[model samples]
Target: MKQIRNFCVIAHIDHGKSTLSDRLLEYTKTIADREMQDQALDNMDLERERGITIKSHAIQMYYDRPSDGKQYTFNLIDTPGHVDFSYEVSRSIAACEGALLLVDASQGIQAQTISNLYLAIDHDLEIIPILNKVDMESAMIDEVSDQIIDLIGCEKEDIVLASGKTGLGVPDIMEAIVERIPAPEGDPGAPLQALIFDSVFNAYRGVIAYFRILNGTMRKGDLVRFVNTGKEYEADEIGVLKMTQHPKDKLEAGNVGYIITGIKESKEIKVGDTITTVERPCEKAIQGFEDVKPMVFAGIFPLDNDDFEDLRDSLEKLQLNDASLVFEPETSAALGFGFRCGFLGMLHLEIVQERLYREFDMDVITTVPNVSYNLMDKSGEEYTVRTPSELPEQHTIEMVEEPYITAQIITKPEFIGTIMTLCMEKRGTLTKQHYLTPERVELSFDLPLAEIVFDFYDRLKSVSRGYASFDYQPIEYRETDLVKLDIRLNGEPVDALSALVHRSKAEAFGRQICKKLKELLPRQQFVIAIQAAVGAKVIARETISALRKDVTAKCYGGDITRKRKLLEKQKAGKRRMRQFGKVEVPQKAFLDVLKL
Candidate 1:
């Protein structure tokens, strides 16, 4: 255990975490020369295509210490840098004893860097500050070094200046990992207590759970039990994770590896569950592991209604891999039977939708995304509303409280004016502002979660010219004047098209949706009335004219009364059709409204 070092590489997005990981792997000779690739730990195709690490990948490396000429075992976990996947980072941190806090030389310290640093501190993990991209022409080495000192309060010489692309300072980083990071402390002879941090599903091998052993040793063919499910199974295989799974007879405490129990059902293995021997189980399960809190809610419905069961199964298997995703069955008048799904953000939702299509061959339609709300009725009964259609009647509701977040934005000083204007337009109140340096500024705000759900990030990037980094955390639910805005086709309301919005912006928002619907909805035999309403009042309206058949074209040579009679008959027919005619809304219409 003294020679074992377990740590992870954490940083903001595109701050050279993966690149540095690649350099380290090469330096340690973990992969062969021909097998090397960019972002080598990111095995998923989607992750490579998007240039982001969507999943946390763990691998074992062997390094030789120069001082004592002793071989050491290093377990390195590479984590995603995006704010949406912070849960993955937390899980990785929980399984490690230290972290490499990488900062970009050009970008300095951003919002996500600060947030992830706090997570490491909360876990009591040792922090190693490293400055990456020092070889770039625009690298602000001195300024960024000072910023890192201010952030972590470490000495000047303790920070490692490295260039991931050029492979500079790679040996120094390895030496620091061996010297600075503390070894894992556990009793190998005690009862086995392993924390399952992540797992994956395979058709041929069944479910493979990746865990960190904290107490005792686990051997192959041992009778093991999952504490959460209370089910026992013989360990089919035990192995360490390299580029591939290297089968082994035993893995001792203070190491990371995988175990296969031949459990076919995905639901049987939970991500945060504990694993132990059936004969001598641990006294208690691990604590401080919290459930994932989804920031956005949307309905995921199958393109074909009969594929509902298939969708459910697909989601179940997907959930096993993505522990953050949550869903329950629901039905919509406009879209039919579907499941209301919760996601960390819009990008996470899109990635899940894309994965379902590619991995499971399940094509799905996702409704407009919205945040959950807390509602109180006149009788003092409170309800948690996820979808707009789930809101109670207007009169019966007493007060509505919406979730708010503390938004932290780090950007250049020159763009502060435009960024402040954008936030104010989104109904955000400025809470605090300070300068990290003369060139870099950090602004904090109290904003409703719903306000930033759609296009706030995109607009922030545009306004700051891609120089801004943003991060947020949920604060509390506050009372607000919220109204349910409904879209009516002809006279009936479409439950899927309803939304809960602030009263101040309801009228303008409704008008925008009404206009977008007018362009997307097709014309029918009768004129279609599209109205956006709040309770009994219609705030916006749009009409699509009918495709007339020219019923009076042949009566031009006859008496004026004949033409009048024909026109009257046509008008009556149209009125009757308008009352009973149903408007067919295309799938594009539901998705297009979110663009507004």
Candidate 2:
């Protein structure tokens, strides 16, 4: 049997992990000679556009060594760099025995890089430190290597300096993988045992589950049962990913690839679940795998009532590939029907929104994302609400609490004051601050998860002139005086725009919502008044001026259809606005409140 090495490529965001993977694919000729695409591993258009790997992808390649006169197969897994999908990355790590840790030569070690490195260490993977982006003029190979040594306790001599963009050190990196990273040691002769790391849906092939053969070989037509769920299926086909080129098939034991079974849904197979033959099923799967829990929740609605079913179907399809995503039918007395969608973090929420618009081709109305809250009622009954609209009345809520996070902000020393001030403004409690270098500092803060969720990172980057890196992990839930701000257009409430804010920032939030409404909603023939209130008190209000010339002066017979169409469009637009009795409030008013 051929020797196999399974490893993952890990790095901070934009640290050249994907680029490096592409070059390696080219060097190994995994793709056809004529096919040329940048970052071949980043298969999704949204992922390419955002310049981040949202999902983990696996590819297999064969390397021929002239020195040893032998061929070796390498199973390379590319993992996400964002902390929001850390759980997915961890699963990817579990399927591999080593990781190619990429660090940007110019940018040095980043927060997420350290975070992922620790995960690799926890997995007991041999680390191969690669200093990427060496083609850039600003690339500081020595400095970045030293920083890696300081942060990760790696020997400076162990760092490999190469440019992933130009295919500089890929061959050497591949050779190092075969030499340093141990080959899979499990016995293929044992009972069939494979761990499912990921699964995808195909229109013609059904569910394709990507698994790592741990202890045994799985052949085509083997009656395999999911060890965790007791569901059995016949493996119709086995295929390996040749990522260097476009993805090709036919994966084998001691390799990483996908298996096509008659199973129609990706939900039936889960990450960390084991697959084995019915005759000799494994009694236990790998431990330490936990179901991902979402931290942020938002309501997803459609502008047109006819689009509600479309939106729901789209979400269901998305959830099939993403187990971390959570959603259920939710309704507001005012907004009719929607879904309360839960995400792992702000980036997760943004990715979902982008996918809903780009992939599903659906225009979505998303409310302000909020963390789930636990509230004590006057009767001392405990209740958990994901949205403000579901919260108890202010008088009835005896105590309110929201989730908190431990945030680490890395920035230049010069902008420390601004970052601290902004954190303080968000009600952040200072925890500790340390200077990583004479010019660079790492600041820690205990802050409300809500405070950091909305554009706090953007604001920090702006204030630091894009020189700051920030990361946070959920710490705990803390008590706070939180209130649900209800937005009304004219007299009716816009449930889609309701927000939970600290009692201290209610008036400012109301004004911001009103301003956003005025900008988003077009001028109507009739006057529109947008108001934000808590209970019976009006906290902020803004007026959208009436359309000055809504009617056409000379309506020719041919222009009648055009005029009617215009009027119909205007009427349709008006329906989207919140109407309380007779008052009309534009839809923008609800959307703008969430914009930072």
Candidate 3:
């Protein structure tokens, strides 16, 4: 067990963590030369196309230490760099003993880098700082090195300078992993207590759970049970993770591996649940990382309503792979059967939407994302509101509270004014401002989660010229003047278009949605009254004029009385049509309003 090293790579997005991981695999000869590829660990097609790691990947490698001339087992988990996938990172961290804190030499320290570093620290994991991309022309090695030193308070000589592209300084990193990072500690003779860090569904083989044995040992054909689910199954297969599964008869304490029990149901296996032998069960299930809290909520419905069950099955399988994704069955008046999915952020939501389409071959419609709100009704009862339609009627509400987040932004000093203005516009309160260096500044603000769910990140990047790195966590909910804005077409409400917005911006937001609907809604025979209303009062309105036939054009030689009579008849027809004519809202309009 002392000869084993379990560690993971952590970094900000695009900081070369995956690339460095590839080089590590090569240096360790885990993958043959021909099999080597960019972001090799990122196996998902969506991940490769987007040039990001959406999931954490684990693989085992054998490294021969030259100093001791001994073979060492290395369990390497490559984690995602984005904030939305931080839950994956945390799970990975819990299963490992150390982390490689990779920093982009050219970009220096970033918001996610700092955020991930704190997670590592909280886990009591050993941190090995690696300054990557040092070979690039824009690499600011000295500056970034100093920043890392100031942040972690490590010595200058301890920082490893490497380039993931050219495979430079990789040998030193491998040596550091063996020398600096501690090996896992557990009792092989004790009752089996394995922590199920992650799992994935397989069409042919059933469910494969990847776990790290904290105590005792697990062997092939052993009868095991999930502590949380209380379901028992024989271990059909047990293996260590490689480029492919390498079947093994037994996995000892301090080792990371996979177990297949032929459990076909996705819900039967839960990530973070403890797995132990039915014969010698552990005393208790391993308490894994904290529960994932979703920051954004949206409704997902199938384009073809008949695919609802398929969508549900797909989500269950997907959730097995991504434990952070949470969803519950919901219905909308306009969209019919769907689910209210809770996502970590917009990118997470988009990735899930894309994955459903690509992996499951299911067409889906995602409603505009919103943050959940808390409310107290006239009866003094508290309720959680996920959708605008869920908000109690205006007269029945006593208080509305929205989730606020403490956002940490790191950027150049010149954009400070614009960033402050942007946060203020979002009804944010500035909390702290500190200079990491003369050129770089870190600003902290408390902003509503709803405000940043839309386009706050994009705008922050644009205003900061892509120099700002943003990270946020939900804080306490506070009372606010929030209104449920409804979009009514011809006196009928479209529930999907309704949103809960801050009272101050309600009118302006309503006006914006009304204008957008006017532009996107197709013209009908009757004039469509696109009205944005609050309660019984209409705050904004736009009219889509009816398509008129040349009824007056045919009466060019008629008297003025005849023309008037024809116009009045046509108007009466339009009024009657308005009562029964249903407006066919284009799918594009529902998606486009999100941009507003």
Candidate with the greatest lDDT versus the true structure: 3
* Native-referenced Cα lDDT, model 1: 0.92
Give the TM-score (vs. native) of candidate 3: 0.97
lDDT at 506 for candidate 2?
94
Candidate 2 clashing pairs, residues 3+ apart or interchain: 30-245, 31-244, 31-245, 239-250, 239-251, 240-251, 492-580, 517-589
TM-score of model 2 relative to the true fold? 0.90
- Local accuracy of candidate 1 as per-residue lDDT tens digits, 345-433: 88899889989998999988887789999999999999899988788788898999999999999999999999999999999999999
lDDT (Cα) of model 3: 0.93
Rank order (by lDDT, best first):
3, 1, 2
Instruction: In candidate 3, list every pair of residues with a backbone clash.
Output: none
TM-score leaderboard ranking: 3, 1, 2
CA deviation > 4 Å runs, candidate 2: 244-253, 519-528, 544-581, 584-596
Per-candidate TM equals 0.97, 0.90, 0.97
Cα RMSD of all models vs. native, in order, equals 1.6, 6.1, 1.5
The per-model lDDT (C-alpha) reads 0.92, 0.81, 0.93
Tens-digit lDDT string for candidate 2 (1-596):
34789999998888888888888888888877578687788889988888889998898888888789888888888888887888778888989889999989888877788788888999899999999998899988777777888887877767887898788987789878988898877776778778888876667877778888877777777788987777988878777777522334333457777777777655577767888888877666757367777888888887777889989878766776676888988887655788889998888888888888987898777778888888889898998888876887788888988899898887788998998899999999899999887767889999998887777877987999988887778878889989889888776787767889898989998998788777887676567778999888999999987665555555556756888887777766655643422544456645555664
Better of 1 and 3 by lDDT: 3
lDDT of 3 at 368: 72
